[model samples]
Target: MRLLHLGNVMMDLVLTVPALPERGGDVVATGSRSAPGGGFNVMAAAARQGLPVTYAGAHGSGPFGDRARAALREEGIDVLLAPRPERDTGFVVCLVDAEGERTFVTSPGAEATLRPTDLAQLRPEREDLVYLSGYGLLYEANRAALTAWVPQLDPAVTLIVDPGPLVRDIPADALQLLMARADWWSCNAREAALHTKIDDPAAAAGALRSRLKRGSALVRTGPDGCLLHHDGTLDVIPGFAVRPVDLNGAGDAHTGVFMAALAHGLAPAAAARRANAAAAMAVTVAGPATAPGADALDAFLRQSRPAPR
Candidate 1:
């Protein structure tokens, strides 16, 4: 089944500062650069794995939008949305501290213009997976649209949801419905804690699993690794030890590779394992959209995780 990515496209400007600035307290950025940040990061993860990927997110006609479009085309992703000239592409300024934690300030653009009308042309198959980003669920404009569209999807079609940082902001009704329909959910520990009201990572994962009914859930714990609960089975997918330079897109990388593995017919446990490795690789790089193809991931995994004595 092909994977369809649904979410925002962003030009994220990452500034490496000594620490996140306090109000009225300025700190000079030691380094900075713009790179693909949000939904496109997920698409990049799938595309790098040579999966058949489609981008249904909004693409604008602004400079950053142009770069986003070209980058998608460069990766051979089928762009499902045309460049909207009325609005510029969205951007986020991310401040990375010495410990690689990040703080973001955002401005909406064309990506936020995603209306329910935007999805009128989509035709999903049961074998295909429609991946939803949490921002789309939280954004008022897209939320109502998705509330109407999700129920209409053929029961045969699979759903993958990543309830990102805005999980707490998602309306209760919307979150309830999506959880009922979602086959897979990916998020970091904090998001899970907020959404599930469970402080423990493992407990949060279990709570989500219980809520999902027919679906599965994954909770990522940086350095500690990831937890996956699939089809009544649960496992702790180990992570690699790496000096993280940037935490951006790490969850997206996990989601993208996890879905890609499932699309390629790998079992849930195997898919989660691959995703863990992929996410471990993401933080090692500086850019938000950095993802390795199958070959590179395989090499890294084999070398970093040698057979036990």
Candidate 2:
């Protein structure tokens, strides 16, 4: 089954700085680069693992949009929607600190202007995986369109929802709706706490899993890997050790590889194990699309020892 991502994929303007500047202060970046970010990371990660993927998001007719489309094509992902010639694609200004932590500021453009007509063109088949993100839900136009369309998806279709860093900012009703419909709800430790009000990752995962209708819950614990709760059992899928140079797309790598593994018929825990490896590999690189390809991932997994359970 193909993976259908209905999330926003925009340009990323990444700045490498020693530290974040103080209020009303400025800091010069040591280095910088631009790339297709946001949902592009996940799609790239999945495609690298041999998943046939499609991007059904808003793109614009400008430099950023051109780069995004080109990047997707380079990764072998299908672009399902045409560019909305009215405005340019949006971009995120990412500041990566010495400790590999990142902070972001967004200037949304065409990606925020999703319409009902765009949503109508999507046609997901049974067993096809559909992905949604909290970033999309944060925009009014995208939120309105997606909330109206998601519930109507075929029940046989698998829904993967990533609450993202802006999880707390999403409206409560919309959050509930997406969570209820998700076949796989993947989020990081902080997002799990925000969504469930439980500080412990395992406890938060348990609470999240209880809300799913017929799906599983995953709480990614950064370098410690992730907790996968399915079939009434919680499994701790361990992570590999690495000196992280950039942590921007680590979660996206984890989620992408996890979904790809599932698409390849791996069990939840087994899929998470591979995802853990992908995330570990992502952070060791210095960009937003650092996920490893299938052969590279296999090589990494073969060389690394599993973490003690």
Q: In lDDT terms, which candidate is top?
A: 2
Can you tell me which runs of candidate 2 are displaced by over 4 Å? 18-26, 98-101
lDDT of 1 by residue, 107-206 (tens): 8888877767778878888899899988877667778878889899898888988888888888889999999999888889999999888999999999
Residue 4 in candidate 1, Cα distance off native in Å: 0.9
User: CA shift at 44, candidate 1, in angstroms?
Assistant: 0.4
All models, RMSD in angstroms: 2.1, 1.5
How do all models score by TM-score? 0.93, 0.95
Please report the candidate that would top TM-score against the real structure.
2
Candidate 1: clashing pairs of residues: none
Cα displacement (Å) at residue 269, model 2: 1.0
Name the lDDT of candidate 2: 0.92
